[model samples]
Target chain A: MSITGIEIRHLRYFVAVVEQRTFRAAALRLHVSQPPLTRQIQQLEDALGVKLLERSARGAEPTAAGKVFYQEARNLLTLAEQAAERTRLAGDGRLGRLDIGVFGSAVLGPIPRIVQRFRQTHPQVELVLHSLDRIGQIKALRERRLTVGFNRFFTEEPDLSWEVIQTERMVVVLPEAHPLAKRAVLSLAEISSEPLILYPRTPRPGFIDQMMRLFHQRHLTAHVSQEVDDLVTAMGLVASGFGLSLLTDSGRKLHVPGTIQVPLRKADAATVDLCVIWRRGDDSPLLAEFLQEARALRHPPPEDAEPVEKPAPRSAKRKRAPKRR
Target chain B: MSITGIEIRHLRYFVAVVEQRTFRAAALRLHVSQPPLTRQIQQLEDALGVKLLERSARGAEPTAAGKVFYQEARNLLTLAEQAAERTRLAGDGRLGRLDIGVFGSAVLGPIPRIVQRFRQTHPQVELVLHSLDRIGQIKALRERRLTVGFNRFFTEEPDLSWEVIQTERMVVVLPEAHPLAKRAVLSLAEISSEPLILYPRTPRPGFIDQMMRLFHQRHLTAHVSQEVDDLVTAMGLVASGFGLSLLTDSGRKLHVPGTIQVPLRKADAATVDLCVIWRRGDDSPLLAEFLQEARALRHPPPEDAEPVEKPAPRSAKRKRAPKRR
Candidate 1:
């Protein structure tokens, strides 16, 4: 049949008539006058070129054609209701999927626990958990794959949206009896002079660089020691008393027995928010539910945390990063 | 907010666009040209007062509003599809729930076996088996809560539609050593005036009525010793050598010790059909599937089964009283 003459409104009206029985009853149910219900039904009949209802003194009955049409009409209505539920979640940008692309880091910590709990509370939604470092997360979010996921919180991408789902404090893992462990929560200034373990530099400056920058800001001389890329291996070297390196509490579940974590006292230390990024217009019901669940678990909004930032706006670029597959 | 202003078709169209991504693509997919799809989208937008599309040269994208709309659109679509499926099932008279009013006697042999097979094949389709008599089955089908169930295949029913899913001639249940049990088959003519046992004429007409009608046609006389309301108890009496009586296959499954079933011949022998009854015009897809499955198992098309009798003209009237529930 020609689709040009059809409208969903007609099906809704038809469903109302069958459910309510009489045109008057359907009209009352629809909260409109009886004439409009009749009009819509007639319009539907004319459009479909079939008389759907056979009216009688007793009530209205569906013709054979009407019977067939009703099956399709009802299917269309159910989908509409689900879409409305998603829209209600979009106001705070805190709702919906956070497709976070993870990159290099291997060990998972308490952040995983937080995410798992969020899922339990909103089981209908799904989380597309992936690995990509900050650069990749930003790109995916711009393309609308993620509503929230890990990304560099410091990035100035305007069209992207982000809110901290959790904050992790930078801490040094060391042997309980080590020399640096005895100092207890040493300042960035004090820690700079010690030999340090480091991660790769190609993927933007690592956390060690951020610490060294703080050291330079304070005119402190930092000692260079063995550099390691892996966090566990770095922690292993610390466990061996080789050197101490920084880590975050986000993955406290990865705590090694021989190593102890002490809070850093650097000016830029203590904590950084793991900002969730999403395209501005990206709307997913499951994602919105996740954002709401995240907010509920984190207690105070991400704004009350140390991370001070607005979500990025919708970007002008299409992302074709061969990653869609 | 106003249900009258909306129809399920809009949501269906909206979900199609969101799922398919691109008005022209969705239009072509739906077998409609782009112009009508555009108009429907525009009208839906106007009604919802939300701009759902971000059309660019390469393709259209969901706007902030569109994403919100998509979520509800999908939900509505799911429910509507489910409802349509139900309607199709209901109309087929095979779709809705069937209480299947049946007498205890009917559940014994072929009937119970048939039902078990039906359940195993259609697990999700609920078929509530009720221990209903001939009267109960007719009443329940009329009330519309229950659909097809087993019953006595004695008479014709006009208000109800039924078929003899299975049929069997009268079989005499008797003590093993009884003289008649030694015979390959016994007819009313040979068993004339023998001590007979059967149900009384209360809720159901006595089996002797059908048997006697056969005897009258054969110009023979039969004798009765005791009367019981249920065939199970009567079979017990027969097994105990109190009397001999005839029953359908349903009464024979009990296989009471010392009793044996011998085929009995007569003009109007007792037979039963595990008949199914559903309201006319109850177009349920589930029911249709059920009937198709059942018909496939039973009829097997014969490579030619009467062109599958298309909704017979002047719906077959039940000549015998439609067994009332």
Candidate 2:
């Protein structure tokens, strides 16, 4: 037989003989008889065309080449074990990297808590966050660069699916010295006539469009004063008394020194949905774990009640309401 | 079955399915039936406690975890093959390390040629040279730190074996302007009364002892003049017109500016044997190859003669002669 005929069992036999220092001891350790062990080592030597061991009355000793082969064989066995362990960890979603697309005000609210909970549960999974607009998020997700994306509104696509994590009621930001700040809640009509600062100016069909649709639903025109790129810029304008600005509930976490956030009247307050989107058939364990953590945080169980009784909605797909935003 | 039960064949089967993208195609490639391939993949996933593939009308595609496992499995398979190839190479003595102990004037001659020839034949073997006397060589060999050692006048040891590679007739070194420089060959009786410089003041029972024994055998007395640590110092004294010194055949290569060397008369020339020593039972292929190269260079094949007619003596163990130095 040629060197190609040397199998894993041959290596096992040779290593045992060298480590145990005798064919009889190795056979005992392997739960086999001595004759076969001797035969296998002879076969291995013949196949490789070299004598690896010198057997004597004392014991068997590895020649120079056998010592080198022993080290390589040990490394191979260890690597084989590591391969299996890493694969199992990856299978359990306890290892590997997860790239997530995040945009706008989602970073200011529930997203951080969801990410924290996921990290605490699966610390080995690497979470890479990318800040992109809705259009950029969709493109990156389709390109497989992102495993999941979070945004205010997502248009339905044949190859993509979106799930609403939670709905946030619109809140108005007014200058601290303004009369509307004194009221606990205000109607959109009360503020519609006032000059408004909107965002973002680009990335069409985004948060700015959602805000415009809210005004259009009431058949009122927004008296635009300034347009900016992000919530921080619009908040800066509102603090300087440029105009009033609207934001989702999560935006309450951002506190500008000269501005106050007041809830809109419930009936007139338009709700914006924060949803996660991904390729429809993605079954990545890391994505599944992250989604589970997000939904659990969205609908936390009552403090005194059993968690099993309140089942989280697997997919809360809202009715397509005229393609709202 | 548990994850520990996953074997090489399971990995092979799963990788084939993923690469081929279907059970039927994978089976065709693996030369197995489709149903068994499908069942093996199911067993692999069950053992891992993770779903690895999503089968549909189009074909099978690996899930995220499956993708990670696929890469790791490929690496493991490649490593396994390398282990076999490396072991085979090592068995043929074409790979590994050979540590050699060397000392004194042997490095000036046959040792270098033997080392170069061995390196040419087994280029991958790492040759490490240690400057050690005969005692140190024996100690290092017992500790397994040395594969072979080369020196002159080895004393027999219970656990070590020595083989003579070649014998060199002694030569005398004198100042270039000395009257004796005119002779083609000299006798020990000619320089018996001249002041002589002896070398290797330390490491007793060494070359100095051997030189002293040679004088006693000829019934001559060496008039001692100076003692130095090494051959270079001894030769330096001789070049400076202080005294004379004797060296083996290889030492003729030393080009001291004011010194000239003349061979001793054939009857009066005491021959020194250059030999290699190692642990008595060491059957290392590296040592065997080195010894063979050294002997081949010593008795080169005659020109215009059949090389097969002369067989090299495997072991020329001379009778122990009163434990000579």
Candidate with best DockQ: 2
User: Candidate 1, residues B58-111: lDDT per residue as tens digits?
Assistant: 768786557767776676656555544444333333333445566666556555
- Note the DockQ of each predicted structure: 0.10, 0.27
TM-score of chain A of each: 0.67, 0.77
Candidate 2 CA-lDDT value: 0.79
State the lDDT of candidate 2 residue by residue for B137-254, as single tens digits. 9899999999889888687788887777778898999999889988999998888888889888878887778887888898998887888898999999999999999888888888
Poorest stretch of ten by lDDT in candidate 2 chain B: B308-317
Q: Which segments of model 1 are wrong by more than 4 Å?
A: A1-7, A28-56, A61-79, A88-94, A97-325, B1-42, B71-82, B108-110, B113-125, B135-168, B172-190, B200-204, B209-221, B232-236, B249-325
Backbone clashes for every candidate come to 74, 0
- Model 1 residue B245 distance off true place after TM-score fit, in angstroms: 3.0
Chain B global fold similarity (TM-score) for predicted model 2 against the true chain B: 0.78
Indicate the docking level reached by candidate 1.
Answer: incorrect
